[model samples]
Target: MKKTMKTTTPITKTLAAAGLAGILMISASGLPSAHVHAETKAAASTNRVTAPTVAPQLVTSKTLQSKEKWLETNIKIPVFQGLTDTKYQDQLNDIIESHASKDMDKWEKEAAEAAANAQKNGYTMHPYQLTINYELTSDGKDDSLISLKVITEGIGMNNGDPRVDTYNFTNEVEAQRVTLEDLFGKDYKSIVDKAVKTAIAADQDQYFANEDGFQSIDAEQSFYVADGKAYIVFQKYSIAPGSTGTPEFAIKLPGKGSDKKPAAAVVKSGAYYKDKNGKIMVQVSVLRQLQFNVKWNGKSKTTEISKGAVWSAVKLNKDAYTLGKMAPRSLGSAPVMKKGHIYVPLAFLTDVLNLNADHSKHGQITVTAAK
Candidate 1:
């Protein structure tokens, strides 16, 4: 987002809001709003996971003075302690330094050009500034995953959108870079597309329409993993108005909290019965509790389930079902029609939709939508 610089003084503190001269503000604690999660005391005891904390050290600071221009630069790098493999740390340092050096040079050139113009036109010039700061998203201690968000802000002739570069690394000896597919598997693209679209759907008016809005996340989309979720980030004005800042959607990461016992379903009232095959069959309408829209087509005798960009189709007495454009897979048991309602195998939730379908001792099925 665009952060305005007030006057020409050196910026020593993180940005805050005021008026046109206000700059982007980060939390005083350096924790992003996206990382905040609330859990009950009982649940916290059962599933306790803490992110690694690292200290940041100021590495570069420079200032330039001239008759008509004043410029300042600041850069800080994170310091990792008790690390066996230093490749990840070394790589991140190099990348941040490289970016800072390039930006400093560019800002210097822009300042000189601006100063010359001010002298000729007899107008005062504002200070030219560049600053690079970082927030630690993840460290490799607990999950062998390291991620960081590096923020760069420049102020000279105009206010520009902050450039954020996210670095994700696997804590291997060689320090391999992590990709969306590596984190979410083969269906990474589809999974991200559905999650982003669903988040945007929450307020479509906040974003642009047609082609100018979001089309799809690229294979190399910007992301960072934190709090058992991978967040997909969009640049300012890329998909929405600047007032929205940088939009990010959190996708539940695979295998997160799997070791811990599944929490009780928040809302667990659904009609389900066990068929002769012993497979739990749930009424198609029950999916509504999990935020799925179910539609019945009498002309084609098909049932469609949709959530944002993801959809699934199944037909009566059909042994197969299709999810999105993927090939059809056997449902193990075809949908059963009874009492003017359609009941599909529990696999419809656990297998096809990738939801959590847990059976309690009392014959009730606990359905939980993926976060």
Candidate 2:
């Protein structure tokens, strides 16, 4: 995590998209910023639960920059490489494609405009550069998480400090990308809101303006993972002007909410159930608690959630689905709707949300965030 800056600027009103020569800027409003349930710790302890074992890493670094008299572009994009598993390697590449090779086109163009305009004003624009970096937050068989950071500086022409944009990703199931909504369950919005405000309240001196000075977490904030924790990220000048530098708060899953004992099968469903295939299937009601929604118009049904993000269950056969294109999935049995309730495979949800479901010897099933 990058350190927050000290010098502060009071944000009176929303800054305009106004720009200076060769300076491309976005207002602070749009910025970066999820949850999970845990299996019973009592059972997990007996099962010997622990963080996923770290695996060997594959690294690939690319430096692309061009410097001229008036305009300059420097970018450092490093992604994981040397993946032995082609499935995962391809997954990494796809993510980078969306972040850098594709996203940079607009940034680069903005830089050029800033340079050309600055030169016309008899000023040599600050050498504009942006760095795209990837940090390995967590490594695992079920949950491998990565954080991507893109920093742009020198162009803003203010304190000349760089603005930060962080994005987090989990390499899982080959086809599907895990989202925060999937991990923490459906109430992530409120969960994050409480968590962030709580952090800000603890260190009120660190921020400016009112008690609600900081905006609530958005759906698409960039975050990173490290040491089995998820850091909700923010850019410099975003929440507390430049003083806060970049703000990151590790989300604390409340683990409070019904805390209902895992559900049973014969009862026809309310929480989780042991499926006919002997797999635990989480009830949609709990999915609702987790922030996952299942919408039906009486024709087909759709499931949506944020587990790290817009995870949609696609390719429905019977019990099998792609689990939203990020996961390679085959259901133990197709999900079924019984008496207005929907059921999903526990294994599938655990993988998508980056959680671990432990079956204890005492006939208990515990689901917790993957650590």
Candidate 3:
């Protein structure tokens, strides 16, 4: 018969041995090599019995490989007409290594530390990139006019998930000849700032209210001093469906100057009204326009009332009481109205009425009544 005994190495025993060895190493500099080897072997044996060692190298390697492949396949570089092939290739390589390297942990850590340091030093990071190209035509005289086509690809990485966005724009630039300075000059910052500001302002104007009621709305307004053009926007409540009343628009113009008011023009277009089935039915040749109307009490009223305006009013479940000229309009579905005032669509006011619309900061609306 063979006898067997279960054996175990406790943490306390191992810790004790390590402590003893450490004390010995510190107290006795002349410890024998044989004794040190014996202690090391014993510690290894105890560690094996107590806890198994885990190696994470394989997992890290696999993850790194997958990320590398993803970057190689997804990353793209635009080849402009003026760029040399070698220079473009070099740039592509640099971008890949800097942005999506396999051994990026160190770089990422360094970048994070640098960013923290910058924040500590009272500096903010505004990361951005843009690419544009265009053609120039001239008869060899004064400054040539440039027809530019711009394509923008931007990434905003905050926290973890990155927001990737793209846009296309076309414009004209004035320059003497085809030079690098012409492409990017002293006015580059101003031009870029103006363009970006315009886009941000437009986006701000397209905002919608999240909460109900008459909260304060703030928006951006633009005016052409020479052309006598002005724009204003406000946020208000939407008219309720099936409600019969007048829809009011409160618009804020650039100035109180009389010349800034829109020209009195009468325009007509087809209008649509919702049927019992809630489907919009088109009403043709319903002339709609905006003009000044005089009330019985001798009050001047600028009314946007037309067949189309009537359709807008009725679809919004409101009554049309004013008449005006027809203009190109993009009307959004009326929101649920609150109180007695019906909020107009920002798009309708901006696109059709040529007013600046902004609901980004606060809710605002401008109402025009006969004065």
Candidate 4:
């Protein structure tokens, strides 16, 4: 007799709670293969498990000159633990080296710059404070997403205006960060700009005068992925009045038209949902289009997907890996197998199947193109 098994958890609710909080605040803030087989529900009901609750460590630094003296600083930063794969580890290390440390250094430099300006102007520098907070927009076993919001204010030291900016990073395709091109295919730039313009037009009063000012979005523009949606974050005066203060918009296609060209790849969309208990839940979809072979063993079920020499496991309801064979790894997010489709993190696609993936279908998802 064929056996069946299923797994569910409240963690999805936790993710939704976290993401919805950030999404509501847009006004203010914001893979691998492997193979095996399954254990039917009748056999494995007692063995169900949930993905790990991602708790990235934070490192804080504070300095004081004197209670009354000037130049006071405070900084908080996040450090992510490396997933099991080496390729993934390298990516994590790069994120820390390039972003984590660089941001902290930037805050420190600001203190120095402020002190210098005050002394030169013959005015006493008050105390300065910088608070950098991080929000988990999306987390998955194969694909994880997070954003850093940096707020630096020189209260007594200066006029006390906070400087803010946000950065978005995705570990897709195993080649550092997810490029706009990789997500939206080749013409992503122009298509994105047009999309943003339409959104601006819909809310004409919220943006600055002259469409020229809000005409485009460069590759380096500020954006974040939360609750399965892309949010384009603009600077204080980029597209809106200063009072709008860091206005943000959800990137959406215009009436299903020119934006018709889909992204090079569809990633985990960050959409928030509520469970029967009314608790918010986050549902993330990885590469549902990717194909994998499944097999069941005497104990549990296993799913395997591969590209070239690299093979990775594609288990649902647990932390999977990008290169299950290259080394031990986990995607940090949970994937689920519902009906016949496997919803997984995009990490499995780029890290495991990228170049080898043929993806022949133009408008729809393509499966295995090669070995």
For residues 1-371, what per-residue lDDT tens digits would candidate 2 score against the true structure?
11111222222221111000111111221122211112221110111112233333544445544333333444544444543335655554555444444334555566677878988999867655544433333443323344334444444433445544444433322222334564465555666677677667666666665754776777655554444445566665666665455566765332324242112211123356676679776553344333343333234554434343445563223655554565455756666665444567776656555556666665555554455
RMSD of 4: 18.1
lDDT (Cα, 0-100) at 216 in candidate 2: 77
Give candidates' CA RMSD values in order: 18.2, 14.9, 31.8, 18.1
Cα displacement (Å) at residue 88, model 4? 6.3
Instruction: Give the Cα error of residue 201 in candidate 1, in Å.
Output: 0.9
Model 4, span 58-92: residue lDDT tens: 11222222121233434333333433234644444
Error of 3 at 45 (Å): 69
TM-score to true structure, per model: 0.53, 0.49, 0.18, 0.47
Output the lDDT of residue 85, model 4.
31
**Candidate 3 C-alpha error for residue 76, in Å:** 7.0
Give per-candidate clash totals. Answer: 0, 39, 29, 36
- TM-score: the better of candidates 1 and 3: 1
Q: Which consecutive 10 residues in model 3 have the weakest lDDT in total? A: 14-23
Model 3 has how many clashing residue pairs?
29
Per-residue lDDT of 1-371 in model 1, one digit per residue for the tens? 11122222332333211000011111111112222222111110112223344323311222222232456666553434334346545545545555555566677777888878888999997778766666556655434566666666767746546666666754533344666765665456876787676666655776788889888988657776777777676766677777656666666665564232223232234566778888778777555434355666656777778867879988889889888998999867899777656789978887888888666676566677666
**Model 2 stretches astray by more than 4 angstroms:** 1-57, 67-69, 81-126, 156-167, 252-371
